[model samples]
Target: MILIALLALPALGALLAFLPGRTGRLAATCVAALTFGLSLRLYSTGPGFWYEFDRAWVPALKLRFHLGVDGISWPLIVLTTLLTLLCCLYSLWKTPDNRLIGLLLALQVGLLGVFVALDLVLFFVAFEVVLLPMYAIIAGWGGPKRRHAARKFVLYTLFGSMLLLIGVVLVVNQTGTADLAKPAGTATLAAFVFLALGFAVKAPLWPLHSWLPDAHSEAPTVGSVLLAGVLLKLGTYGLIRVAIPVAPTGAHKAAPVLAGLAVGAILIGGLICLAQTELKRLIAYSSVGHMGFVLLGIATMTATGLQAALIGNLAHGLITGLLFFLVGALKDRTHTGELAELGGLRESSPQLAGLLGFAALASLGLPGLAGFWGEAFAVIAAAQRGWWVAAALAAVGGAIAAAYLLRLLRKVTHGPSTLKLTGPAGYELAAWAPLVVGTVAVGLAPLLVTGVTGPAVDALVEAFTK
Candidate 1:
């Protein structure tokens, strides 16, 4: 019942968000907030899945409405709810059209469903649910190139979806069960390749990532936050949730290739960030690098590596979501995100500048922050797995991450006051403060996340070893 309600609330809110005036917006925000509280409460009711619900949805096809959560999906569920709540709060201050609010709530439905889904068909349905509303969000509410960016996003992800569907068919045909926990015979390498390519495009790894910067740069603030925060996680989450567990043989064979791509993204993404002059695009590219760390963690196929990947996913959601919010706030004030067009922001808006500085540090994997644990542990896991070369490459990528992020801080926040900017607004602070606390809290005490995700990773690793 809790699982069904958790999945249904946002969807119901989507229609309610269309109600007239501020009432609709308030309803939307309340729905998101309530969902967050519910998710947290569900997680807190001891460890493992709380709202266990399974029902036959498509008997002829062997599909069921299977829904549950373990350590792996629990934090991500919390993340999706938290980000949605924050995004709703941020939207309240600006008060976009009621329909946009509705779309956001609708988006939340898909995101929440994806995390808890225990069946592949269910996961795919939830996966595709996210596409339409996001497309509308970008195309309708984005920047000058919003239409182009939105279309590109659809094309790339849609193509990826086709591959994903193919992979799903192969897996289902071979296993005859949609339940993720029930092991199937070793999936063929082609099935794994199809799945990896499909997920990678959404993950936007390396070459497949070209659409992300444009999408991020053009999207509305709420759209960008959700995009970076949750949409991207779907891909990495799929890799962990589906690709590895179902296809261990294929995963083992492909580890080196995945590791290589991870390194490429780390190095290539950093270099690209160094060349980016626009703030949003630069941050978008940084995602490519940060997600690289997550891929590396999974490639190691060790408990520590999986733990690193899970924590990294949470940290990236917190840190990158904060960065996007700050950038959006900065852009709102300056009317531009060009590094040269904005300078000495700290002098004009100390709070914004200070938050930006802290977020930048977190993004760069500064020790004691949330970002450090994942990057540090991923490399350690890689080395322990005897992928020394990949480990060294990841280490180098971390140094470059620091360089690029610091350069961004120096250029945008530290110069002489070049623009007369309104100081941080109350709502802006209200929106950013949680992300700030999360980054620092997770950094200072990584155990907050690791403790919950560790057991799941161990079990996952054991499955892979078998």
Candidate 2:
């Protein structure tokens, strides 16, 4: 029941928020908070274990209305719940229309479903559910190029979803079961490729990533947070949870290719970031580099590597979420992200400047921040596998990380506070503080994430090595 509540509450909230006036934003925010509480309560009742509810939906096909969360799922689940709560709160000051709030809640419900769903069909359905509202948000409310961005986003993602569906079909057909917990067969290379392409598009790996920057730049603040902070993880998560586990031999066969592409994305994304002026676009490219570390982790197929991937996901969410929020604020006041025209933000808004500095430093892989361990440890783990070349490439990625982030910070935070404003408002400060606190807390205490993820990685190592 708690599990159901975790999935259903947002949906109910979305439905009710359709009611006329009467604090629709407040109602939606309360629902998100309540949902987060429910998730915590569920986690507490369990002794660091998966809470699953499975019952036959079709005995003829072995599919079920299955849902569960292990250590791997829990971190992402916590991520989903936490980010959703933040999104709701953040929506308070910039509250759009009540319909928008309801729509955002709908997106949250679907994203939650995607993270915990166990059945392949359930996963796919949940995954697709996130598309419409997001597309609507982008197309309906985005910037000058919103329609194009939304179209690109929808087309690319749907194309990837098709590939993913093909992969699911092959796997289910081969294994006679869609349950994620069961051991996958070793004989499904073709199916694996189908799945990888689909997931990669979301991972937005290299060639498939064209849509992301445009989407992020155009979408509203809450949309960008969830998109960066959660939506993209859907790809990498599916890779680890479904693709690799279902076809180990195929995964091993593709490891080299995946590793190469991961390295390429890092370098290329870094170069692109250096050239980009649009605030959102720069952050979008950084995502390309960040997820490369995740792909490298998966490519190494080692326990430590996998841990790096999981932790990296958390770090990217925190760092990028903050980046988007700040970008949105800047856009609100100055009405432009063109670096050539914008200058001296620190003077204009010391609070935004200070927070941006911390997030930027954290993003550059400063030791104390959440961003450090995932890439650093991923390279270390990769070296142990004699994949030192890839490790070196990852090091280059880090250097590029420094290049782009420093460039962004210099422009956004330095100079002479180009756009002036009254200092941070109460609600604005309230909204911004959680993300700032999150970055610092995770940076200082990396284990809040790594501890939860380590066991899951160990399980993977044991499975693969055996």
Q: Which residue runs of candidate 1 sit more than 4 Å off their true CA positions?
A: 44-48
Every candidate's lDDT: 0.89, 0.83
State model 2's lDDT: 0.83
User: What are the models' TM-scores?
Assistant: 0.98, 0.96
Expressed as tens digits, the lDDT of each residue in 40-150 for candidate 2 is 765532222468888887788777988887778777887787787787777766764777778788888888888788888889999999999889878876888889999
lDDT of 1 by residue, 319-385 (tens): 9999999999899888999998888988988878888999999999999999999999999999999
CA lDDT of 133 in candidate 2?
Answer: 87
